[model samples]
Every structure is written in structure tokens, then in C-alpha cells.
Target chain A: MPIVQFTPFSSLVQPAFWHALTDLKIDVLRLSDEAIPVHGSYSAGRSVKDRESGAEIALGCNLSVGGESFSKEDKAPAHSVSATGVFKNYNTIEEFKAADKTALFAQVSDEIWKSITVDRSTAQLSRFLLITFADLKKYKYYYWFAFPAFAAKPAWEIQGDWKGASDEFSDTFLSAIESAQLASPRAFFLVRPKAGSDEPELAPVEEYDTFFANVNPVERTIAFLDPSAAPGNPGWPLRNLLTYLAALHPATSHRVLCWRDAERPAGAPFKSRFGVVSQGAGTGEAASTEKPAAVGWEKNVQGKLGPRVADLAPMMDPTRLADQAV
Target chain B: MHAIQQQYWAVRDYLSPVLKESKFKEHGRITPEEFVAAGDFLAYKFPVWSWEKGDASKARDYLPADKQYLVTRGVPCLRRATALAYTDADEDAERLLSFGDLSATGNEADEWVETHAGRAASTLDSAANAGNIDEIPDVDESSADDVADQVGRMHIQGGVGSLGEIPDMDEIPDMEEEGLEAGDDEATAAPKAAAPSSGVIEASEVEVAKGNLLQVRTYDVMITYDKYYQTPRIWLIGYDENRTPLMPAQIFQDVSADHAFKTVTIEAFPHSTSLQAASVHPCKHASVMKKVIERMNQGVLEEQRKAFGAGAVSPSTGKDKQKKWLFRRTSGPGKDAPALPAGEDDVEGMRVDFYLVVFLKFIASIVPTIEVDSTTAF
Candidate 1:
């Protein structure tokens, strides 16, 4: 069995997001360093295949935020799953650099654990944290993104080679899943055989017990909108989902379906994958009782865990605009 | 047979509403009906371009509910206009200055010159003409001094402030120690301590030197029918390398220097809700389209002469035929005749349906770096 390694989420902060942040800082958050809630979104990953080698190249999962991120009333774009995040805007660069990131990570991990075990909310699985210092005068920003995922005591392992959904399921079954996903996009769901029929149907994760009723635990299949394009691995969101699942049915094996539909060429069928995964004994109980250690601060372009800078002077500074207009 | 067919089309076109009732042939302006026909033709030829129903509140009642405007998003601009080679700068500068003079004087006789010269200047001038004496002094002095001073201040503060602030460096090690004391997993703590110390110091330095050189910007270019101008208008929205929206001034670097401020102005897009974008002024679009249509007509006439002899379709007694002949003679030389593909020329001359296709070709010069039209060969 291959040790399942999940691809980490990469931050894609749209230019509109920065412009909106600048507006927010000036109009609403002047001199305030409070953490405000922001919204972001992620869709199923598109696989970039090596033309010659035919090997699937993992374009790291992207969590993107845009101009609408500041508006709590706004929803994610069509066919994407929304994520909630805490945005901490420091008053100065010194404050941003000197802040305790490790403690910040721990706090977020604790909140996520509580959401899963206490509140039983499935959406909390994709919560993230962002810290920033916006230099409005220069139109430059210094920021870091952290997508925390619990490190399972004994990590989940794949029991067999993953097969494409097209090869594993009939056309009718795949179409049913597609319709369900289109009707309501969710991060996680359960795929069960419809009662009195061999066809498959998707149900929300909250209905886990009723969804899998009278079915064997080994045959039960859990599905998620996978944001990883890598053939051998799933995305980071699946880590905490597995933790939530283990808490529900401790120390059990279940089939996992990684639903990837976004990146396919026009007219091509969905390219989802399915495999078997099992957790270690009593791992679910520990996750429910104790806060698990987490790891997912995004690495910069240099492959180092440091803040990225966006020098937007050319695009945001009024003085620069005046000069260009002349 | 060809001459007879050409004569029949010439007669039909004379009676056609586009020519008889509308001013499309004479003034280049089209009626709303003609605009819809052109839009449909453009959408059919280029699937990349599709009609979109924009914000419902902003939708115009004149256009169809579903086909309010045409849009194509994420058009990759691989290089800035400044990056292109401007080999014909002198000719373009002279032509562009003449255009400015003509517009200032309000002379429509040189209207065709504005169309031809505008296209040539957009292609040849690119952004290098920004260095022309007429436009360079204020921009160079203001931007160069301001940018240099700002860059210097940023380096001094960013470099010295981070290094001099001892607590910043001290805090990383302290956090590592705390993680170890708390029995934190090695998976999380190892990456943090390994990078931030040395990486942060080096990253700031590297960012200062090579930031602009590596990044490429993208543009979302849209075309909509202008009711007042009765011509197709183009709008542009730019994004930086990180997919962040570019400021109005920043977008100037991607527009051809000759057209940037003179022909392209910031205006609220009609289809969008309060979204201000840079749009190519449609004041000259009708003239350019008129010139293009005349050129297409000349191509068909040239083919008619080659196949059926010059005397075969001589101007008849009708006043319309004589007027058309006189207009063609005075329009200009056949040197710039459109290179229509062999055997594909329509006997009735270029259809108004192909209006947007030719319009895009004229616009490609103004936004030389944007690769929106390359996929659809005219």
C-alpha cells in the first residue's frame, strides 16, 4: 500500500482582492488590527498531463480569493466550494513580521477541531488563515497564507491502485453524481447505492448514518471534490475530512472517491478517481478528544516558508497613474 | 456571367435598406438592425467570442435580452507594447501628430486619412513613440524621479528595518523553542525554522531587482455596439502577473503609445455595473470601418476587371452607379487593397455581416500586444 501524500493548497490572491483589501483598510479598518472574516473558493483541480510521458503532473491545489471576498453575503462562483478564513491586517510591517505564526496556527487548528467534533460542521474542514501588512502609501503588500490540516496520528494509507471513475462506474452512475454535484456543490459528500436499485446517489456528509444504513462498512464510499491533480495523491482538504470521518466511524476502512471535474478538455467525460483507504486503530477517538498537530503554511515561489510581497505601485498608486497619464 | 451577377448585386445593394435608408455605406455608421447582423456574424466565426447578457440593471433595451454585448476574457498579453520593436517610429509619429491636428480642426475630408494613418501609427509607433519629443518630457521627468526615489526609500526601509529590528530575528527562534516545548510535530516546525530567517532577507533583495522583468499581464477585451456612435466599441480590463487588476495608469503600458491617451479613455462600461474600464474612443471607428469597406469593394472591383475586363462593368446611366464610380476614384490608390483570398470574394462586395471581423483587425493595431484575435484569422 502506498503512503497517501496530499498536495497542499497554494494561494492565488486575485488583483481584485488586493484592491478590495486596500478599500477595506482605508474605509472600514483604519488603524485597526482586528482579524476580519474573509471568503475564498476552490474548485476541482485540473491535471496537467505530460504530453510525452503521459504522467499526471500535480498543479498544486489553488485557493483563490477575489474582490467579493470582503462581502460576507457573496457566494462562491459557480461549481466551486467556498472556504472561510480569518484575515489579520497588521498596522505596520514590523507587527506583521514579529507576530507569532506558530501560536496562530495552533489557535486555528483548535477552532477547526471544535467545529468537527463539537459542532459537527463539515464546512469547517476548509478553514484557513491569512496575515498581512498593507503599505497603502506605496501600494505594496506583505502577506502569508496558511491552510491548516490536522496531521493524523497514524496517517491514512491507500490500500490499492486508484482507478479512474469512468473505468470503475457505469455512465448512468457517473451522470447521477454529476447532476448531484451541479445541483449543490459541496466539499464532501457520501456516495451510496440507491435503495432497490444498483445506481449510485450522492448525499450530504451530515446524513452519513442514514446514507450508509444497512450497508457494510468496507463497501461504504466517501467522496470529496479533490483539488489535487496528482495521480497518486489527494488534496490537503481530504486530510481533515478523513479525521472527521474517523471520528464518526473509528478505526474503519472505507472507499474514497476523489471527484476531479474541472480541467478536462472540452467534450471529455469527468476524470475522477476511486481507491480504498483505511485509518489506524483508535485514531478517530484521539482526533475527537485532543487537538491534532497541523501543518500547511504555503511556501513562497522560492520554496521557503516566508511571506510573499506584491508591489502593486504601478497598478494602484495614484501618483504613478498621474505620471503615466502625462 | 460574373459581370451580370455583380450588376445584379450592385442594383440590389443600391435598394438595400443599409445603403438606401441607412448611412452605413456613406458615413460608416450602421442602424441597430445592421449592428445585430454584424454581431451575429462575429459570434459565428469566432467561438472564443460569445454574446453575454451583462448586469440586468444595466442592460440596454435596444439589444436582444441574451445578446447584449460580445466579450472574451483572459486574453493573454505575452509581452508589453514597449517590449515590441518599433522600427517605423518617425513615420508613425508624423502621422499620429497629423491625426491630432485633424481631429482638433474637425475636418471630415481627411477622415479616411485618420483611419489609414491611425492604423499605421498604432502598428508602427507601438509604445516607443512615447519617447517622442511631443510626449516624453513631463512623463520622463515626473515618473523617473518619483520611481527612483520611491525605490530607494523602499530598499532602505525594508532592508535596514528588518535587519536592525533584532526582535524580529529573535522571535523566530523563540517560536521554535516554544513549539519544541509543546511537543509539536516535527512536520510543522521543521519547515518554519528552516526558511524564514535567511529566506526573508534574500527574498526582499531579489524582489527589488527582478520583479517587473518576470511578470506578464493579461487583458479581458470586449466589444459592444455603441448606440450613439452606431459603431462597435472596444473596452479593456488588464490584470498583472498575479491576476490582480491593473490600475488605469498601469494599463497604458500595454496600449500602443499613439492611441493610449489620445484615442483610449477611461469610461464606465455600459454592460457592467459601475465598472470603469479603458475603452477605445469610437469617434474614429466609423471612418476606419468605412475605409475598410471601400477597400473591400475595390478588391472585388479589381477581381471583376481581371476576370471580365475593365469595360465590362462600366458605369451605367443611373445616377447611383455614377456616384459610386466617382467615390471609388477619389477614395485613394489601390496600393492598400485588402488581400482577400482567391475565389472567396463575394460578388455583392463585403457584407455588413462581416463588419465586426474587419473591426477587430483595425483594433488589433491599437492593442498590439493582446493576443485576442490571433486565434481567428481574418
Candidate 2:
């Protein structure tokens, strides 16, 4: 899979960015049909299933802001933007039946537009890395897409290009070159109040009990709640919604580290551009070099160290796209 | 421990079965009346009624064969009379009767009244300590005559007035009759002679009106009324008009020895969380002094004596503080005998001698102990 470091447009009006994202050449992870894996510590294990189930069922994502972003902050820097996490189904079942995938692509695009337009949405794109194949048996698979903020319409149109704005670098390495909204997520859920006297108030959790309707605060993942598990038994619904919310307004983010490609931690067996040195003295050992041939500061330098860049190239092996990526 | 246990059992046998037949097992939500009544019962039953080192004395308990078991460690407290006895009169009698060999017992028998010297300083609940209980019987114990008749007899004996001039009034009312008249609206008043007008016509017998000197000084105002004789008993520690407390020596000297047996001095235990006084029993000398002056100003000492005549309404297991005996602001033979008057005071700061309330409660506790009154008491 070749990751193009794809940067989605700031405006959903950009036909170009969406065109490239919808392009079929490069393989991508289908988060819309997948599940995210989590490992954790505690659970109420009074039941046989509960006792057997090891590790708390934590539905998390690489895009989480360490669980803190789930809470709104009044003093967040203006440049610090959040992506709404939106999920979309990949239409795997249709593909199996040999169906045209344009409708599927269109659904994804529509959700992308919604994410850009919707305020405080749950359409984040970086949530894809949270998917875990091990969990496919539970909720099956799904995909996530992230869409950033855009200006209100009528008075202005999104330029589709964000310039002069400083990119937020919680990490300095791999920058978020682009982002996109997964418009119509197949699994996203919004907890709607049950009608009538026992009508639910519109909030994540009512009276502190996790209400499982179209939202699941516990699982931190959102999916259309099981229709059968309506007003009561909101556990599954709320958990899915919460997980999706967590993925979007992640409390922490997964950082891809791209080190300077130069520095290594100190104190090791010496490997020089010239020759390998064995059992080298700690630092002040360059003084013992029989070849008194070195530059300034060499008089004070210690071990034999080499500074040379290694050559690298992309391999031209031919592998199937599905096997390599999704 | 045995004395305390006995006190516990005495109350447990009564107030317990607090709500249901649960007793102490489940002292669930008690009505305020129960709270006041139970508070008093617990206080009296578990007084810090301890004695100093061998200054203590014991009474003969010839019941159980094992002498050790027969004799309890603590000194007798809250005796039926002024002088201490082996144990409470009823408890001692019950124990003695429980023996296989029925033994002889009397007020003078099982009792071991401290030698005059032993009780010399310890009789702190003397009249010198607090309220004027009955100093005079007003009438002889065996006399069945009402106050009017008693006065009539004295007049006839003196030959001062003629019988014809004495207007005939049937069913001569007792001394407490007017109080009852004042309480029950339907009860008609007996006719008084044309001479003895309605408005306090110089109550010929001024001594009856004196009603024995009353002084309720301390917060723990101990009021003990002789149930059998139906006379008020109080141990005062307040001042006379002279502002000087009854001198210690004057108490013993002024009272006759015979007067001692008829009076039982119900003492006060300091207020604890369980048992509290209406006015916190002031601890410091200055505070106690202030409380005394405050009590005098309220004329509670005067109020209590009047209430004594009004007769006790008895603390029912009711939440209304007004129903509790300790709830009087000013006392008289008011409705149902001072019932409404008792309601006038705020429960807080209103002086409540929990011990006194509990005592009356026990008098009416009459729940016939299982061992004692298995059937019924006549």
C-alpha cells in the first residue's frame, strides 16, 4: 500500500481532493467494516462470559487525545482544530455480489460533505488506525473519516486550500497533510430520546447511567444502535456512540514517529565509515588514535564515530493490492 | 456491671419492643415522645451512679446460695427513700421473693440506710441541693377527708364557727379538686359559703398555699413526687429571698427524721448525648450561677410547684413535646392540667429534666415485667 501522505481539502467543495481520495489505485484500510482492538485492566466479572472475558473491552483509537479531548476546553488555541469522526460502510457485501461501487463512493462523499458542514460532528478520518481485525466478530467492520472545520456558507465559500494557518504539531514528525469526512458512516449512532412520558433527555448519559440508544458512552464507538435494543438496554448503542466520539474528539492522538534519520543513543560498539572499533573507550579516546590525522575538536574527541548517510530505494516487487493494504 | 445491667433490664422490659416487638433489637425511628421518654429512662437507668473507694456500702442479698452472686458490686441508688438501700425497693423485693426459701423483707429489713455519718456529706441531693418537695403532709396519711373537711374539722374542734353558718355543699372537693375543675369544663364547682368569695378569699389556711418552699435552680431540676402518698418531693439547691442557698447544716437539722422516709430524692445525672437537659446543665460555676439566676427569673421553681398540684399528665409515647412532662413554661391547672401551657415553650432551651420525665414514665411504664406481673397487677 502506498500512502500518498494525502491531505484532504479544508473545504468539501474541492472536487480535486475528493477525486484523488476516491481514486481506486492505492489500497486503503477499510475502517467502515472493521473494528478497533483495545487492551485494559478492570471489569465486573460476575457472569461466566464476564469471567472468561479477559482485558476490559476498551474501544479506543490512535486518534484519541489521551481521553482528554472528549471534554470541551474553553481555552483551546484557535489554530488547534478538531476533526469530526464519521464512519461509512465499505459495501463489502455488495462487492461480493459484483455490484457497481459508485453508489458506495457517493455515500462516502456525502458524509464527507456533512462532516465539513456539520458543527461538532463525529466524522474524524484519523480514527481508521483504531480498527482491529480481532474485533470483527463483535461489531463486524467499519471505516472512519475525519473532516475539519470550514466557514459558514452564503457569505463565503471554502477556498479548499488552508494557507497562512499554522499546522498544529502535537508531534513534529509526520504532519497531517490532509483530512477527509466519511460522510455517511454505516455504523455511526446518535442517541435520540425515546418518546413520551419516559422520554429521554437529549444528552450523552441521562442521570449518570449510560443510556444505550443511538449512543454508547462506555465503548466510545458510535454505530446505529441495534434497532431492537431501543429505549431500554442502551449499553451497546451508547458504547458505540461514545467510542466514535472518542475517536473523533480523541483525548490523545497516535503519533507516527519519523526520527531525524541521523542521531542514535550514545554509548555503543563503534561503527565508523572507515573501520569498526572493538571495546572502545568511553569518550576521551580519540587521543589514542595512532593516525594523528583528524580535524579540529578531534584533539578533544573520544571514540571513533562515523557520520555517513545510508542509501535507500523503493522496491519494485509486485504484490496484490488487497493483500498488501486492506 | 450488674447494677447497670439491672437498670438496662428495667427499661428494656418496658420501652423496648420500641416499635414492633423488637425492643432494643430494632430501635428504629422512635416518635419524639418515645425519644424524650426513652431518653429519660436510659439516663436514670444508667446514671454515673458510682461510689468512691470503700466509702461504699452493700446490702444483704440472701437470695442466691452463692453469696458472691447474691451481692452485686455497686451501691444501692435511687432508693425508695432518702436513705440509700440494698437496691431499688421493687428490685430487691422481687429478688428476695425469687428465692426458694422465702425470706422476710420490709422497708427496714433488706435496706441498709447509711449511718448518719456515712451519708453526712454524700446526701448531696438534700433540700440544700435543689426544689422544695413536700415539707408538710397537709393531711394525715390515714385521713380520707378533703381539705375543706379537714379545715371544717379544725374549725368545729376550735369551736370558732357554728355548723349552721357552714353552707352545705355536697361532695366536698379535695385539695386537687379545683385543678380538675379548671381542667374539665363540664365539672360544676361546689358552692362556697356566701362568706368565702371566689377570688382568693384569704385562703384561711395560709400554710397550704405556702406549698412548701420551691426553688428550681439547676438545669437538672429533680422533681420526685411520692406516688403512694401523692405529694410532691423536690431537692432544691437554689436561694431564698436572701440570695443565699439553704445552708448545708440547716437541711438535716430543719427536717425531721420521720420526714425522710416519706420522701425519695430523685437525683440528676449530668447531661449526655442520650439524656439532655432543657437548658444545658451548666458545668462551670459561673454558668451554673447564671443558669440559677435565669431559672429564678423564669419562675420555674414556682411553676413546677404549681404543676405538681396540677398533677402529672404522664409522658405518653407521643411526639408532641407538650405531652412530655418536661415541657412546661409556666405551670398551673391549665387545660388537661397545664397541657397547653407546656406547649408554649420551644423544645430547645425549655428546661427538661429528662430524669424527671423518665421517672414519671417508669411510674406509668407499668408494662408488668414478665417475671413479676405475668398475669396482672390489681
Candidate 3:
């Protein structure tokens, strides 16, 4: 048994999402405001097993974005973070090329190619993080665009002298990501992530009789058809449709309903990084350190308090719309 | 709930007519003429035998209790009148009654009617529904004299037509005379006519021809295993146009290796047409059931895999996966194809392919459930 809280891709008015969350024992983090789009949510138990050994695979990865929106004049900057890499089945670049459907394969045996590496864990870990969004639109952007771009980038291809690197990611990998295709008022899932893992394993469960059991297919199928709402109100209907998916899936705990208020703190790092912070001194103690930081004036600062650069990484589409026209 | 109930009633009503017109129409008719044609263009192609032979006691045993009661109590004279009408086709009744086939159970016939009615609402079946009955083959006066006579009496008895004096019996051909006429293809001369006093030329006969035309016969048969308590006993009554009784019929044959059930055919009366001849049921094995279950599981698994951020396994199932793979691979040579530039170092594409195959195979192993076949041939 695991806990999952479903967040809509847009709004959280859907009773289905709340019902699903309550059943899963995951506190519903209502994405009530207009900011975050609520898509769908669910949590369940899952085991990532090694292909050869049939044993659980231990893996870790972080998801991040590189671009942000600006008002009048702001320069877009490139960003990157470096981390240590472990080659589990370390093989020469040649061995990788001949292997069909392998997680990693060699393209060439040159010095520049030696620096490049591709692994299933790298892409998969990133995907596990993106499905946590409650909004379908956001989830769509992550799956349809961002994940493909990451997969398309050549696994850190290196040029002469190991300086210039070509981005080689495959769009095919994004096809593997799943969507919470349920839209109902009373549905929930048990999300149990593997031990020592941040991601919750998701398993969808619907209430039928007093017994907690797997839902009959009729109800489950309806949820998948429209995961936001149960075809009542057309406005933000996706929220209601996705509510049915809160049960029995992986990454169920990641579901968050948008909770936006005029005075509420921003949820993501990107929101605060780009938005101006207020110094209202509501708690007096923090004010004692600064010369009483400006309070209401901070709201006027443009682009700093809203969605920031890192949040967009999972949703970035480098191909400008105007470029497509050409 | 009301709509469902209404649908059920409609099914019941439609079935009643199909069973009557198709299975029991020729029951009490005197003519050896084909009752209902399978196709209008093929009119003489398929003959429909009647189910009744006109004897009250015999017809009583073949009809269901309720129907017998209706004929006896609701319209008392119908049984005897129909019996007289069936005199010309008594042999047909005897032939139809002998080939007993249990597969032709009235209940199954009713169910077929119900299923057909239920499917009639679908857009695909609307054409078939509209084409029914406004389109039945016509029966002329010359082809249906006995049926015409029987129905005429019935209408008059029910007070449905103007009452008139019964015509003379000598004028109309009796069973013996009709049998002589049936054997003689070429007539030497016109037979002498009798005065219209033997119930042969009643105005009721005209009304029966113009309206109240009898098209089919229906028997309400109730087969019970219990034998005691004769009061309100179960009866299987057969009837012709004039409510004549029909004899029981049965046929048995063997065919096919895989299908072990016997092919039992039974002829219906008057028209002397053979009905459906087939097995009642064919058993299935446990292995077949297991395969069906597996297919269902695979389908559900494939659906779940299509969710967002679902990176664990391939979401697609069945032919769609193959179609997609072929389409993507053949789009172009280098377009979107994963490739390494010349002079590149060790690129590990092999490992990626390995994991992808393992994941695909894992998902493909489970089978999805398919709908079961419930119909039995008869």
C-alpha cells in the first residue's frame, strides 16, 4: 500500500482528484490557483529490475530546465550541471554499436566518441520526475517535447580535443512515458517507490464494495478515456478527466494540486528565482537582520517572482514556431 | 429502466411473429403449397412446412398450455375448423412431425429474435430492420383455397365479418376428390357445379381472401420433465390457418470430424420444407479458455502503459506496434535515425538497443482477452 495525491494539469476543482487522493492516504495538495495546470496523478508499487539479472536496479537522477520567460529585454543564458557517471556494464564503444535494442551502443571507436555515453537509467530517471505534474498540458509539454529533446541529444558527443559536444538525444524514448488517463471523482492509487527512492511506485485502485480491490474494467476504462473530468463541464474538463487516475500508479506521491494565493510562497525554484521576493516582515525576526527589506514594492518587479528557468527544462521546445513556418 | 423494458417487450413481440410465420405457419393449412419463401426471387426454391394437422387432441399435445387454452376458451371453434382446412395436407403434417429435433427449441428461437431486436438499433443494422415485412411474398386465391376457407370461418366465428349462410359441401372439392385432382395433371372436362348451399361459397371466404389473410401457424409447446398433476397440464398445440393440428417431425444425420454433435433435421407441415439441421452444442477445451484470458490481460497492460511519464515499458499492443515501427523505419534513410558522425569515439548504441528489446519482449509476453463466442449452430 502506498500514498498518492493527484494534481490536475490545470485546476483542482475536480472531486475525482480529491476522492482519489483521500483513498490513497496522500494529502491532496490542491493546485487550486490558475498557475499550475492539473493533469492527472496516481501512485503504486513498482520495481525497476535489471534486464539480465532480473534484480532491482538502484538509480538516481535529477530533472531541470534551462530557459525562462522575460518581459521587455532579458538575455537568455545557457546552463549545465556536471555530475559523476558510473559505467555499470563498461564496454568499448564498438561493442555498443552491434547490440540490438541495447540500453547503450557504440557509434564509433574514435577518441571523441569515447567521451559520449547513453544509458536507459539516464533518460528513465528524468521521465520519472516529470510525470509528477498535476497538469496535462505541462505533462504534455514534458512528454511530447522536452523528453524527446533530451533523448535526441547525442549522449554528450565530444569533438576534437574533448571541447565541443553535440547534443544527441532520441525522441523515441518519450514514447515510453505513461499518462494518468483517468477522469473520475472517486478513484485513488497506492504509490510505493522502491526503498530509498524519491519516486513513488504507483498502482491505480478504485473503490467498489467495502473491500479495497482492483476496479472492474468498465470504470477503469472510462477514467482512461477522459482523465480530467467525467464529461460534465467543458471548462478545465481535463482536470476532472485526470482525477480518475489518482489510483494505483507509480509517482503517485508527486501529484500536487495547485495552491496559488496572492500571499502564498512560490512552490518551484524557478518561480522564486525569477520573481521579486517581498520583505513584509510578517514574522519580525527575519526583519531584524536586514534594514527592513522592501515589502509591497517587490510585487512590481517583472518576471522574477513567476515561473523561472529551471522549471522549463522539462518543457522546453527549442524549435520556435516562426522557424516551423520556414 | 423503462427503455430497457420496452426493448425487451419489442424483442418478445418480434420473436413471436418470426416463430409464427417461419416455424409454424404451414401447421394447419390444407394446401401442399410452400407457405413462406426464403427469398421472393427464389419463391418456389424453399418450401415452409406447416406445424398443425387439425386433430384437436393431437394439436393439443403439440401446443403449449396457454395457447391451447386461448384457442379452446378464447376462440372455441378455431381448433375444429382449422382441422378441416388441414385435411388436404394431413400427410405433410405427418411427415413434419416425425423428424424430431430438440435444437429447434422455441426458447432459442425467442432468444434469436431478442438478439436481432437488440442489434436493430445500431446504425449498421437499420437497413435490415426497415426492409422487413413490407416485403413478404404474396399468396393468390388459387394457391390458398383451403387456407382461405379456414380463415373465412374463423373470421366469421369471431364476428369479424358479415354473417352469411354456409355454402354446400358438394360444391367444394372434398379431401378424396382433391386427392384425385392432385394426381391428375390434365383434366378431361370441367366438373359439374353444385348449388351454393354446402358452406362452399360463403361471403366470409371473400373476406378471408381480401383481409384477415392467414400467413403462418404457431404452436406454443411446453416440454416439462415432470409427469404428475394433469390439471392445467403443459400442452404443445400446433395450428394451421383454420387452427388445424400438425404432426411432429424429426431427422438425424452425421457430419464433420471436429464437430461431434449430430445433425438433426425436422420437416414442418403443409409446405413440407426441411428446417435447420445441426448440432445443439460443441464443447471447448480448458487450454482455449486460458489463451483467451491471456489475450485480455495483455490488452489491459498495454492500455496502462500509455499513461504520461510512463517510461517503464512500451505502451503499444498488437498490430499497431508493428505498423508504427515499419512507418518510422521507412520514413527516410538518415532523417531522425540515430547515427554517429565519422571520426567519433566509442558511442555505446548497442547497450541502448539491448535494453529496448528486453522491455519490448517483457510487455509482449502477456496476452489480452478477446470476446467469447456464445452462439451454437442448429
Q: Per-prediction DockQ, in order?
A: 0.07, 0.00, 0.00
| Root-mean-square deviation of Cα positions for candidate 2 versus the true structure, in angstroms | 43.1
Runs in model 2 deviating more than 4 A are A1-326, B1-144, B149-234, B241-243, B247-378
> Please, what are the lDDT tens digits per residue for candidate 1 over residues A127-209?
99999989888777777888988887786777866677777777678777876776677899988777677688778888888
The i-RMS of candidate 1 is 15.8
| Per-residue alpha-carbon lDDT of candidate 1 for residues B6-34, written as tens digits (9 for 90 to 100) | 35644653454432246676778887677
Task: Write candidate 3's Cα lDDT for B1-378 as tens digits.
Answer: 323543564365334321222111112111111111111111111111112222233233323432222111000111111112223434333311110122221111111111111111112111011111111122232244543443333221222122121112222121111111113111110011121231221111211222222112223221111111111111222322222222211000011111111111111111111111111110121133233334433433343334222532233544333222211111123244422211222111111111112211221111000000001010
Please provide TM-scores, in order, for all candidate models, with all chains considered together: 0.59, 0.14, 0.13
RMSD of 1: 15.3
User: What is the C-alpha lDDT profile of model 2 across B137-248, one tens digit per residue?
Assistant: 3324524344334223321121213212111222112211121111211111111112222112111111112222212111112322211211112222211211112222
Better of 1 and 3 by DockQ: 1
The model with the greater lDDT, 1 or 3, is 1
- Model 2 CAPRI rating: incorrect
- Best prediction by DockQ: 1
TM-score attained by model 3 = 0.13
- Quality class of the docking in candidate 3, CAPRI style: incorrect
Against the true structure, candidate 3 has what lDDT?
Answer: 0.18
**Which candidate, 1 or 2, has the higher lDDT?**
1
